[model samples]
Target: MKKTMKDQKMVLIILLSNIFIAFLGIGLVIPVMPSFMNLMHLTGQTMGYLVAVFAMAQLIMSPFTGRWVDRYGRKKMIIIGLFLFAVSELIFGLGTNVSVLYIARVLGGISAAFIMPGVTAYIADVTSDEERPQAMGYMSAAISTGFIIGPGIGGFLAEYGIRMPFLFAAAIAFVACVSSIFVLKEPLTKTQLAEIAANAKQANFISDFKRSLQPLYFIAFIIVFVLAFGLSAYETVFSLFSDHKFGFTPKDIAVIITISSIFGVIVQIFLFGKMVDRLGEKKLIQICLIAGAILAAVSTMISGFWTVLTVTCFIFLAFDLLRPALTTFLSRAAGIEQGFVAGMNSTYTSLGNIVGPALGGILFDVNINFPYLFSAVIIVIGLGITIFWKEKQLG
Candidate 1:
């Protein structure tokens, strides 16, 4: 029994490590995006397209990836996803043309489609219903840690060359892929696999997704979408906005993001699970939405570096808290259809990712503050939807 427990702990560590590396790869290039735009002589609109294209690919692939996770098993999908991430990063690092950058984004999106659902399903397979929230909190902390560390490293490395961070990210992802191949184990039993197969035969991806759209589930999906959209609007234009407003460089932008992400990591690690248990998902979501909307709006008005940092820290804290809460709600509501629901979650998030950057880019060209203002409005609308929603309608 002790040996079994020890093995499970090791497996959990491996899963967390893989997730951390995947997210790190995503965050590592963020500080250098504006430099890429300058090198390509791209406009804000083109930059938006660059950001949105990745999410668009994820949006198209997530449903299929979710189904594949159940059919093929999580371990295989995870390894493949990490391998793709490495290849995509390497391509991005080496490429000079904008077309090649597009190809890299598409590959990265596809890799995310596979990895996100696979990781979520694997966690569900290993954890009991009651323990799932805490597990998810840990997962969120891993992602937060990656975001916290990646930007600092990327910014520092960019001194060597803008491409250096991309290469570093590729190396890290390759290491993760190799580790997953040797260390990761499938959590699903034969019985679970047989049941999953039977269910898969009866329902296609579209059908499974449609069936999961209960009112509570729909609300959960909407929350995920709004959160992603609001955050992405800020993220997609943040460096550019900072540069225009304060003449901040890549290193300055990296420091701001890293500091905000540090607060996010702390919230996810030390407070998220406890808050969810005490407040419940519904109440927590409402509180976060309101707080996030206010902070996001206020963030646009800040003038100094310290002021911006303080506001963004609160904004990130609220966002980080909302993520685990909403995910926990959806996971509890999903029951046995873990992979399908998780895929749908990614799909909605990808849709938001697509729209947010596109709109933000256009608004940024209009005025630097427009994106944040728009995000605040959108978040307020999301809050209103949650307020009117009835819990009993889920049944």
Candidate 2:
């Protein structure tokens, strides 16, 4: 029994590491995005579309990706996903043109679509219902920790060359992929796959677009879309906004994001599961939305380094907490359909992501602060939607 438990813990570690690498890859490019733009002489609008393109690919591929995981097996999809991640990063690092960059982002998105659901479903298969939330918290912590480290490293690496960070990300991801091939084992048995296959015919992501909606999930999915939209709007152009507005260098941008994310990482590591147990997902979601909206507005008004850092810290805290809260709520309501819910979450998030960057990019071109202001408005609207939502409906 003890040996079994030890092995399970190791497997969880391996799975969570994939999330860390993916987010780290994401954070790696953020600080250098402005430099990349300048190198290509790309406008804010073009850059926004650049960011949006990733989501567009993810959105397009996500519905099918989920099915592929269930059909092909989690470990198989994860291996493929990681390899794709490595390819995307390397391509982005080597590319000299905008079209090439778009191709890289598309591959990155598809990798994300594969890895997230694949790893998540793999974990769900191995863990009990009671152990699932804590495991999920660990997953979120991995992402937060990535945010803490990736930008800081990427910023300093920019000193060497703007493309250096992408190359570094690619190298590490390839290593992880090769390691996973040898170290990871498929956890699902024949019976488990058969059980999941039984529910495989439920409404997929794209099917919902034409239908009215499932009232049980309608409000929750709406909030998901708004949350992703609002976050992506400001986030897509954050580096450029900083560069143009305050003349902050890549290192300065990295310092701020890294520092701001540190506190959130700590909270996720220690307090996240308990906070969810105490506050319930609905209340926590509401709190985060309001706090985030206020912080988004405040971030734009602040000029000093310390003040901006402080506001940004709170902003990251709200987002870090909000994501898990929403995800936990969805998972709880999902019952045996964890993979399906995870896929839906990715789909709605992609929808928000697709729209947010495009609009935010245009707005940023007009005024650097417009993206944040626009995000605040969107978040406030999300809060309003949640006001009437009762927690019991999740059942």
Candidate 3:
């Protein structure tokens, strides 16, 4: 069935809105998390472990959530995920203990595992190959916009109290949740539904997972892992680096994140998908990875607020473009099992999250700039993987 323009527009709005709210909650916490932990009297490895815990939870649950979306429906998974996110946010408000906060993050991670893959699969279901890259870009831009707003708002509110940000984040999520329930529609076609039904009944999780490890998928996985890893590492160390190098306050760093987020939105919304459609995601991925790596390496050479901020904005643009194209390519590659396939993509990302922040934290204790340099090395390796990886004829 040919989709109407209205259907496409509605789905686009719904998907973008969902992503916007989710990231709003996340970005709000990013600037304040280390300080929040300090309030609980935690530091060092404990904080690193907390970061790992969030990623680890997502890694553990993503595959199951993906499969569940395949068997059930994307809409169902989305609503459930958002509901869980609401609960997680409430948990944050209910406690001041580090242990309780850790549990909230774990819950948040699980919610994320479900929400992200489900939304990707839903967009895949609605959009044609020709339209998909652009749609993905728009969704990514919505996320970047949230990143821009959330940090600034969170930082401002944090002066009153950290818990206030949590309350505000949750309130925003609740509003989005209500909008999702009424506004989002399931867009899967009959053939797509049948395809999922057939695959869902007989596919062995372990066997199918092993078989899904084609060179293209493997390359895509590596690309996503490196991208996520590098970004997470940067985020984990940003506050620390800003403080040490430029004596930046939390509010100042929040402003940096907000500005970088604006660059990220421009790149994702205006540049990325169209660039990929014109140049191909494969070439764009290669270019962005190389450029990002170079920029990251250069970031280590800079000191003080202005230089760091300049490089950070460039890095954000590089990152914003790379991720959407990577995800769009991976979703297209999944063929009939889009949810499960997309889930694996999320799993690899979570794996990167688990590794990047932990390693960055450990390296930070050793030297402040090592993490950035290390991220450059990882990106180069991913670019090399993309070179030899064969492209599969998806769909």
Highest lDDT scorer: 1
Could you give the C-alpha RMSD of every candidate to the true structure, in order shown? 3.0, 3.3, 2.6
How far residue 156's Cα lies from its native spot in candidate 3, in Å, is 3.5
Give me candidate 2's TM-score against the actual structure.
0.86
The runs of at least 3 residues in candidate 2 whose Cα sits more than 4 Å from the true structure, single-residue gaps closed, are 1-7, 31-48, 96-99, 155-163, 202-205, 208-212, 237-252, 300-303, 364-370, 393-395
Q: Compared with the true structure, what per-residue lDDT tens digits does model 1 show for residues 198-266?
A: 877553556756755767577788889999999888887888899998888778787888888887887
The 10-residue segment of model 1 with minimum total lDDT is 1-10
Show the colliding residue pairs in model 2: none
Evaluated at residue 97, the lDDT of candidate 2 is 91
Model 1 residue pairs with clashes: none
Error of 1 at 268 (Å): 0.9
lDDT-wise, the better of 1 and 2 is 1
Better of 1 and 3 by TM-score: 3
Off by over 4 Å in 3: 4-7, 31-46, 96-99, 159-161, 189-194, 201-209, 249-252, 391-395
lDDT of 1 at 297: 84
Model 1: residue 60 alpha-carbon error in angstroms: 0.6
Candidate 1, lDDT over the whole model: 0.83
* Residue 237 lDDT (model 2): 85
lDDT of 2 at 307: 79
Q: Pairing residues by index, what is the TM-score of model 3? A: 0.90
